[model samples]
Target: MSTATDLAELTARVRAHLALRHPDSPIGDLKTLPGGHSGLTYSVTAGDARYVVKAVPPGQRPVGRNDVLRQARVLGALAGSAVPVPAVVASDDRQPAWFAMDFAAGEAVEPVLDAPEVPAGTARARMLEIASVLRRLHGTDIRTPGLGAPEPLDAAGELARWSRTLHAVPAELRPGGEELLTRLADALPSDGRQPVLLHGDFRLGNVLCAGERAVAVVDWEIWSVGDPRIDLGWFLLFTDHRNFPHLGRAVPGLPTEAELLDTYRDGRPPLPAMDWFRALGRMKMAAIMGHNLRRHREGKHHDPDQERLPPTIAAMIRTARDLLA
Candidate 1:
């Protein structure tokens, strides 16, 4: 249960933990996994068994508590579903607050997104593959046991949820965020469909792709029951011109908003008022970034890149406003 700052200490702890839960397995070749803003990940081999351990940093308090346990629950919920998630092995919320899952081998699509040019066919295929995975995830029955009960969401609740958090942001950043939220609330979509489970942070970086196929969807901190279109909106907005105009030139292979929607909907009912949902997505990002900025200022989680978040928040606010206009 003690925290380990060095690999030697961590390896020893892993050996002890394994001896208790998995007596026959002996630890070897332990290494830290990379690439996540929050949570520490480690890869270990024990008697030919390979798995990953995800741990919350000692004093790091995420926006809504460290969600390692929730993440474990989510993986368990998706057990028999088509969605690809790492298999959870063990978890505990003490001291280090960690969980273990079968290790997935693949690179995240995040790096591919940074490529300046991707062959047209490759780009289209990758886009379709990603969209297919999303389609399956949403299609999974939320009424299943391990998955929590579905919670209905509407424009008002979404606004209030982010508004409460937005209030704490610096006064200078409040005007734009508030204005954008007001516009979103006014234009809220009236699509009358039951809520479906949503992958809250659905994006390239969050998905692990091996050989052009999405092998595993990582990071379940914000997953919840909500409007399914919001997931699509979130993805489309990232590629939208206003959000990051330079991205198209800097990084090719991104599907157009129309293409992604078509693939996701897959001849099902058409999405309702995409612009409004996209604006909401932008506002959500703004609120999150603003919250992170506040945390940075308060020295809650010391990240050097957090120094660059204010302008990003401002840009997101502007993009949200423009989406409404």
Candidate 2:
């Protein structure tokens, strides 16, 4: 078990701790992995074996996404599944709590496919592969060990959670959220589905890839079991640049939304209505942007890019309204 508290000190300390665990081992420098929110992620080595450690900030109680063990549980359950996941080597809940997983080697692809160094054809193939993998994930047996029968989606609660975030934002920033949300709540899809594990934020940005295939879906922090449409619709949004106007469109080689749907729906039953689901995904994303943008403008956080979100948020709500109409 590690006793280090300061995250900055972990580069050497984590390696030292692990080296003791695996004597005559861990010859490389430790790396602080990127993009995690508040959690401390480290790439450490032990005896020619590389593993990633996802930890709650040392000395604090794990709560919500900070609960690294919950992520470990999901990853552990998915280890041998068709969906790619790293293997959990260890986890500890005591102070400086963390879980270790064998490092799954692959490139962490960006959300904008065209930006990757790979050929456009490879990026296009990755999207189709993601669709294929997502379908298999949605079809995985929910009865799998460590995750039992999941609660059917609580549609009202889901809407309410995002509603609170929208309400928290300045009215101008969250333009038309009220109307979009109202229509979304009314058209909410059936809460019932034969539930399966959801990657929650399933998207190209969330996966690591090698040669048009996703080698691992790495973030399990928000994973839950519920209507698979929640995962599907959210992923489909990234294919179109309008959903993220600040990010600009480099969509030429990527699969169209219709084409991706065809890939995901190949063996499943005729697809259910997806318009409402798509609108709900838009509303949820807008709520998140509104809240974060407000925080940015208020100086609580300072991401200059969020200054551009007002129009993006407006467009999302406007489009959602049209979808509902």
Candidates in order have lDDT scores of 0.71, 0.77
Report the C-alpha displacement of residue 121, candidate 1, in angstroms. Answer: 5.5
For candidate 1, give the lDDT of residue 183.
83
Clashes of each: 0, 0
**1-325 in candidate 2: lDDT tens per residue?**
2344365455555565566668776446556787676577878777678989888876677877888888888888887999998988777666556788888888866546335555668778998999999998987877888864446565555567778877888888877878887787778766356666788889888888987779999888888877777787788888877677766556568788888998999956655757877887788788888888888888988999788778778888898899899
Off by over 4 Å in 2: 1-5, 8-21, 27-30, 111-118, 148-150
Tell me the lDDT of model 2 at 258: 87
lDDT of 2 at 224: 81
**For residues 1-325, could you state the per-residue lDDT of candidate 1 as single tens digits?**
2244554555666667766767877677567776655577778877878888876666665334366777787899897679999988777665556778887886655423354344555555666778888999888788878777547665666667777777778867545877776787787777655677788888766777776777888888778877777787787755543464323233355677788888888898777778777877777777777778778778987776666666667777787788789
Model 1 RMSD in angstroms? 3.5
**How many angstroms is residue 296 displaced in model 1 relative to the true structure, after the best TM-score fit?**
3.4
Task: In model 2, state the lDDT of residue 235.
Answer: 86
